[model samples]
Target: MEILQIDDTLSLKRTVDGGTEEQRKAVKAIISEVRAAGDQALRAFTEKFDAVKLDDFRVTEEEILEAYHAVSSAVVEIITEAAANIRTYHEKQLRPSWMTTAENGTMLGQKVTPLDSVGVYVPGGTAAYPSSVLMNVIPAITAGVERIVMVSPPGQDGKLPPGVLVAADIAGVKEIYKVGGAQAIAALAYGTETIKPVDKITGPGNIFVALAKREVFGDVAIDMIAGPSEIGILADDTARANEIAADLLSQAEHDPRACAVLVTTSRTLAENVLDEVYKQLPHLPRKDIATEAIENFGAIYVADDLEEAVGAINQLAPEHLEIVTENPVGLLGKIKHAGAIFLGRYSSEPVGDYFAGPNHVLPTNGTARFSSPLSVEDFQKKSSIILYSEQAMNENGAKIAEFARLEGLEAHARAVEARLK
Candidate 1:
C-alpha cells in the first residue's frame, strides 16, 4: 500500500464500468429477444451462457426441501436468525397511509402503498451469496409486497446453491427461478411464459446484469447501478494496525476494483498499517484478487489532524466508513456522507454486511453523496391525496381557476370551475 500526505489533489473518484459497446449491444439484443419470444428466449440464453438446459425455470417445493437436506442444520438456524433480525429492522421503516383535515374541510396527505410485485436477482454458479438474498428480499417482504420472485443462474448440475435456496425461503420469497444474467433481468421486466413481470428489480450481478438493469430501467424500477465494494477507515494512533489491515483486506478480497483506504492523523500509524497490510496479504485465500486491489486502489493517507482526515473521507463518500478513533461516536456529527458508518473497532464492516440489520445493498462509486441504501421505501411508493369539501371548493375555486388561467390552461380552469357549487 502507498502512503501519502492528504491533499486536495487526492481523489477517490473512480470511473464506473459502463460496459463495452459490444456488451451493451448484446444486452439490448437479449432484452429484445426475451420480450419477443418470452420463455423460448430464456431457455436458449440459459443453455448458451450457463451451459444448462431446463424445461422449467421455476424451483419446485421438492427442490427446496432437498436444499434443506443439502446444508447443515446449523446453517439453516443461522439464516433463520439473520432473517428475523433483518425483518425486525425493516419493519420499523414501514409507514401507514395518513391524511389530515383542517377547518376549511380540505384533506391532504400521502398514501403509502407497497409495490405489487418485485424481482430479486442473486448471482450464482461457483459461489453463493446467501447474504445478498436476505439483504434484498427481507426489506421488500417487510414492506408487504404481494409477490416476491428470485432468480439466479443454475450450475452445470442444473441446481441452485443450497445456501441461496435456504436464504430465500427464510426471507419469505415463495417464487425462485433457475436463470440469470441479462436474460433473467429481461424475464423479470417483460414477463415470460412462467415468470410474470415485476414492478421493480433489485440486487447486484456481473457487468451484463448491470447493463441489463440499465437497459430496462425506464420500463421498470431498478435499485441502482452498483459498483464493486469499498471501505474507508478513519483512525488514529490509538487504533491497532493489524486490525485495520485485516478490515481493509475484507473488502479488497471482494473484487479487483474494490477500494480500501485509510486516513489517519498519525504518520507512524499510517506506516505501520502499510506494513501490516503487506504482511497479511500473502496469507489470504483470495490473495491474487486482494493484491491487485491493494496494488491499484488501496492507499494510506497521513492527515495533519482529525478534522482533515474526516474532510477527506467526506469527499470520498465511501460505501462503508469505519471510525476507529479513541472517541468514534464524538466524530459522528462531522460525517455528512457514507452508505453506512461503523463506530469503534468492534463494529467491523462485515457485521453490517451479514449479521447486522442494515442493508448491504448500498450506493457505490461516490453515489453515497446523493443516494441511500436499499430500504423499505424503495419497495413502496407514495401517492399524494387531495380532497375538498363543497364549501372549501366554493371559497378557493375562483382563485384556482385564476392561477390555472395564468398558465393559459383554459381546460384546467374550466375543470375546477365546473366542480364549484
Candidate 2:
C-alpha cells in the first residue's frame, strides 16, 4: 500500500458509471430478450452464462430436504443463531399506523404497509453467500412481506450450494430459483409464465446484475446500485497496526477493485501498518485478488491532526468506518457520513458483516452521503391518511376557494365551494 500526505486531495469515485459501453449493451440486450421470450429466454441465458441446461428453474421440496441433510448440523446451528439475531434487530424497526385528531375534527396519520412480494439475488458458484441470504430476507420477513423469492445460479455440477439452501430455509424463504445474472433480474421484474412478478428486489451481484437492476428499477423497486466493497479506518498511535492491517485485508479479498484505506495522525503507525500489510498479504488464500486490490486501490494517509483525519473521512464518505483511537466515543459525534460505524479496536468490521445483527448490505461509492443501509423500511411503504369533518371543511373551504381562484382555476375553487352551502 502507498502512503500519502493528507495535504493532497483524493478522488473517491473509482469507476465510470454503468461500466463500459460494451457491458451496458450486453446487459440491455439480455433484459430485452428476457422480457420478450420469458421462460425460453431464461433457460437459454442460464445455459449460456452458467454452462448448464435445466428443465425446471424452481427448486423442489425434495431438493431443499436434501440440502438440509447434506450440510453439517453444526453449520445449520450457526446459521440459525445468526438468523435469530437478525430477526431481533429488525423487529425493533417495525412501525405501527397512528392517527391524531384535533379540536377542529381533522384527522391526519400515516399507514405503514409491507410489500406483497420481494426477490433476492444471490451470487452463485465460488461466491457462496449464506450470510447475504440472512441479511436480505430477514428484514422483509420482519416487515411482514408475504412472499420471498431467491435466485442463484447452479454449480457446474448443476446443484445449488447446500449451505445457501439451508440458510434460505432458515430465513423463511420458500421460493428458490435456479437462474441468475441479468436474465434472472428481468424475470423477477416482469413475471414469466412460471415465476410471478415481485414488488421489490434486494441483494448484490456482479456488474451485469447491478445494471439489470438499474434498468428495471421503475417497474419494480431495488435496494441500491452497490459498487465494490470498501473500508476506511481512522486510527491513532494507541491503535494496533497488526489489527488494522488484518481488518483492511478482509474487504480487499472480495474483489480486485475493492478499496481499503487508513488515515491516522501518527506517521510511525502508518509505516507499521504498511509493513504489517505486506507481511500478511502472502498468507491469505485469496492473496492474488487481495494483492491486485491493494496495489490498485488501497492507501494510507498521514494527517497532521485528528480533526484533519475526520475531515478526510467525511469527504470520502466510506461504506464502513472504524474509529480506533484514545477517545473513540468522543470522535463518534463528529462523524457526518458513513454507512456503518465500528468504534474501538475490539469492534472489528467483520463483527457487523457476519454476526452483529446489523444489515451488511450498505451504500457504496460515496452513496453513504445521502443513502442508507438495508432495513425493514426498504421493504415497506407508507400512505398518508387525511379526513375532514363537515365543520372543519366549512371553516377552511372559503379560504381554499380564494387561494384556488387566485391561482386562476375556476374548477378548483368550485370543488371546494360546492360543499360550502
Candidate 3:
C-alpha cells in the first residue's frame, strides 16, 4: 500500500467499462437472437457458454427441495433471519398513494404502483453470492411486484449453487432459471417462450452482463452500471491498525479492480496500517486477487486534521465508508456523500454486506455523488393524478386555452374548449 499526502490531484474515480466493440457486437447478436428464436436461442446459448444442455431452463420445486437438503440447517436459519431483517428495513421505505383537494374542487397527487414484473441476475462463475439474491430480490418483493424471476449460470454439473437456491426461496422468489451471461439478460429484457419479459432488471454481473444491461436499458428499465467494490475509511489515532487493514482487504478480495483507501490524521497509524495490510495479505485464500487490488489501487493518506480527512473522503464518494474516529457519530452530519456509512469501530463494512438491514447493492466508481443504493423505490413507479370539477374547469378553461394557444398548439386549445362547451 502506498502512503501519500491528500491533495486536489488525488481522486478515486475509475473509468466505467463500456466493453470492447467486439463484446458489444456479440451482445447485440445474442439479444437479437433471443428476441427472434425465444426459447431455442436460450437453450443454444446455455449449452455454448455454460456447457450445460437443458431442455427446460426453469428450476423445479423438487430441485429447490434438494437444495434445502444440500445446505446446512444453520445456514438456512441465518438466511431466513437476514431475509426478515431486509424485509423489515425495506417495508419502511414503502409510501402510500396520496391526494389533496382544495376549495376549487381540484384533486392532484401521485399514485405509487409496484412494477408488474422484475428480473434479478445473480452471477455464477468463480463464486456464488447468495447475499446478492437477498439484496436484489427482497426490495422488489417488499414493493409487491407480482412476478420476480431469478437467473444464474449452472455449473458443469447442470445445477445452480445450493446456497443461491436457498436464499432465493427464503426471499420469496418462485421463479429461478439456469442460464446466465448476456443471453440471460436478453431473455429478461425480451420475453422467451418460457420466461416472460420483466419491467426492470437489477443485480451485478461480469462485463458482458453489464453491456447487455446497457443495450437493453431503454426498452426495459435497469439498475445502474455498477463497478467493482470500494471501501474508504476515515480514522484517527484511536482506531486500531489491524482491524482497519482487515476491513480494507474484505473489499479488495472481491475483484482485482477493487479499491481500498484510508485517510487519517495520524502518520503513525498510516504507517502501521500499511505494514499490517502487507502482513495480512499473504494469509488470505484470495491472496492473488487481493494483492493485485492492493498493489494497484490501495492507498493511505495522512491528513492535517479530522476536517481535512472528512473532506477528502467526501471527494472519494466511496461505495462503503467507515468512520473509526474517536467520535464517529459526531462526524455524520459533515459527510456529504457515501453509499453507506459505518460509524465507530464495531460497525464494519461487512455488517452491511450480509447481516445488516441496509441493501448492499450500492453505486460504485464515484457514482454515489449522484445516485443511491437499490431500494423499494427502484421497483415502483409513480403516476400523476389530476381531477377537476365542472366549476373548476369553467373557471380556468379560457386561461388554459390561451396558454396552449400561446405555445401555438391549436389542437390542445381546441380540446379544452370542446370540453368546456
lDDT of 1 at 162: 90
lDDT of 3 by residue, 106-138 (tens): 999999999999999999987999999999999
Model 1: worst 10 consecutive residues (lDDT sum)? 6-15
| Model 3, global lDDT | 0.95
Off-target runs (Cα >4 Å) in candidate 1 are: none
Task: Note the residue pairs that clash in candidate 1.
Answer: none
lDDT of 2: 0.92
For model 1, residues 121-214, the per-residue Cα lDDT tens digits are: 9997536999999999999988989999999999999999999999999888899999999999999999998999999999999999999999
Clashes per candidate, residues 3 or more apart or on different chains: 0, 0, 0
TM-score for each predicted model, relative to the true structure: 0.98, 0.97, 0.98
* lDDT scores in order: 0.94, 0.92, 0.95
Candidate 2 residues 143-180, lDDT tens each?
99999999998888677898899999999999999999
